[model samples]
Target: MRKKLLHIICLASMILLFSCSGDVTDELPALTRAQLSINLLNNGDVDQQEEINSIRFIVFGSTPGGVRLDVNEHILLSTPETATDIDAQLLKVTSSNDILVVVIANEPQSLTSKLDGIASHWTLQDMLYDISDILNSDGQIISTTGMPMIGVVRGISIAPDETQKVEMVIERAVARVDVFLEAIDGGAVTGYTAGSTSVTLHNLSHDSYFVMGNVGNGTRDNADSSKNYGKVKENVPEIDLLTDTWTAATSDTWAYSSATGAKNRRLLCSFYTAERIFKSDYSDRLAVSMAYVPKGPSDVTGITEKVIETITKVDDKGSPTAQPFTEIRRNNVYQITARVGKIGIQILTVTVEDWGDRQDIDLDMDL
Candidate 1:
């Protein structure tokens, strides 16, 4: 599943500079300066379309080598955040005959280090890392957000003074998990007695790394395999479902992979049980057991306490047969569902849905 992503350029006009030959007459029409009308199609979480803080695009000389984002400010860049489309005008020059266009949207200023690291060879992994603990100065986890669509158009050349329309298709670099609580016959987790219980998906990956352009989805030089690129951070907080039928998912659970991987990643989750102590080694694939708090009916006086909680994992399509290991991919949504009751907890998997595309992941999940 280490797939190479191709950069799609909607439109682009390459410009070339040359020395003057003989004295030319005014018969030829005057050429306008190089300009670009950048059209940004909304990408990323459907709800995050309006969250764009700023947009930036860089122009570089087209070569076998790549360009850098933090290198020079004069390569012709723009930060037009308000428009679905932006017009950028560049100063005339003559060193290189071709250029590349890279547009990064909604990037956090905290990652400004990437500005200097942004180059043709750098992948999204090179420019970023995951923040599992969104903590305050006092060390309390905060609700932090992450996601940025990257678009790149390379090898673009324009006839002298001709304007080009480069359509850039930026794609999400990570996967999204949406937890849903499907209680049967008004169970304990049926939004009725949700206050007394807490549930969590274990082994959540906290870090990710990948290359860009036609390069592989993993490390640039297999740099992170042993360090193992991404892993679930220890002591990660549980996902509280609250009063709603679903867990409080203000944003994606984690931003890790953009497509299926050669590795088999599973979401080890527990039933809606009472709050339990959280501990685990980030490096282990299947670490400690999930948390579960068993409790009888709050109002029923004659009812006896419950025990023997059973947990079953189902296929991606919620089939009766559960997968030995649930496979995951990027730019997709995995809805891990739970049906709670006095008997036990059955975890069901809804079909995997790609963020911006309609084709669902085939249940085979074999890369």
Candidate 2:
């Protein structure tokens, strides 16, 4: 599934110097004042309430020779709006020097304040691109403020009398995982029904950078095994029970037939995590541990115990293998599909998707 992203368009209008009678005059210096209008367009379906909570614009000015100047400042444009698309206007006097605009959205108040306190350009860049503490007090992936996003439009030549339209694209700072489970009757395992299932994700990173770069301050890398990940978590648990009504149904699984004659699988769990890489030996790679209990009356006797399985990767024939799932990246979605039967659980497919692109990793395992 694709995540909804926000598209931002900036319109900058700079006015020319005018005489007392409102006529053009060469006697006065050119006016450097500008009025900027930013229209934030929701790119996909209806907006989620917490998708955008606040927006901050930072404008940095430097000399033509790329010499860093002290003319750098940031402004909070406005609180988030409920409309499908939002427009914010900013009027300010800026120099004619080349400017770089950095727009950030949905950052928490504490992080925003900390960003505002930094005075040095290089220091601010370091803090903005890489930081920790992404989790909340409840240990959730992101705070109530929402998913943080950042966009940069640099090397903008701010002329005295010109109108410019700049379009910026913002991206999510975290990755999402969606897990699906289905029970089918086609394989060697039969007469067993779907049951109460629990999906546990392993080796998740807690800290993530605001922007993408090679020098990661949090996640572990495949090349280096000893470096510490920013508080790497193992066996993060998520459990969902099968209701009595669904378990007693005629179908063997929690899937329902669609109008197109396709079975819609049940979503076991979903979550967000920071980026991370597996070790060279694939010892610390990401994985999922699943537990399934047979629900209702089962055809097979003496099956009261639940089955537990850990899946990292599998071969073409649905058996565990040593192939590594190398890395998890930001602004991406990973979907894992598995089938449960009398024998045990079999991972069917794993797919990684970005906003527009998708790739499939076909690895199967029987537990």
> Which candidate number has the best TM-score?
2
lDDT of 1 by residue, 1-367 (tens): 1111222222333343333334644222333234355454444333344333445555556334444332223221233242234444343432334455555544444554565455653343355444232223322222132244445555455565344454545644445444444333322323222343333344445343321331222211245343222222234344421111122222111211334551112232222111111233322222121123232343211111211122234444655543333233444455444444445444433455554444322222100
User: Over 4 Å off in model 2, which ranges?
Assistant: 1-31, 47-50, 64-83, 91-98, 128-143, 185-196, 212-263, 293-324, 341-343, 356-367
Candidate 2 per-residue lDDT, tens place, 198-300, comes to 4566655555445332112212233553322122222323221111111212334442333475554565556566655545555455566654433224433
| lDDT, residue 135, model 1 | 26
Off by over 4 Å in 1: 1-33, 43-48, 63-99, 117-125, 132-146, 155-163, 185-189, 192-195, 210-328, 341-343, 359-367
Compute each candidate's TM-score over C-alphas: 0.50, 0.64
CA-lDDT, candidates in order: 0.36, 0.49
Model 1 poorest ten-residue lDDT run: 300-309
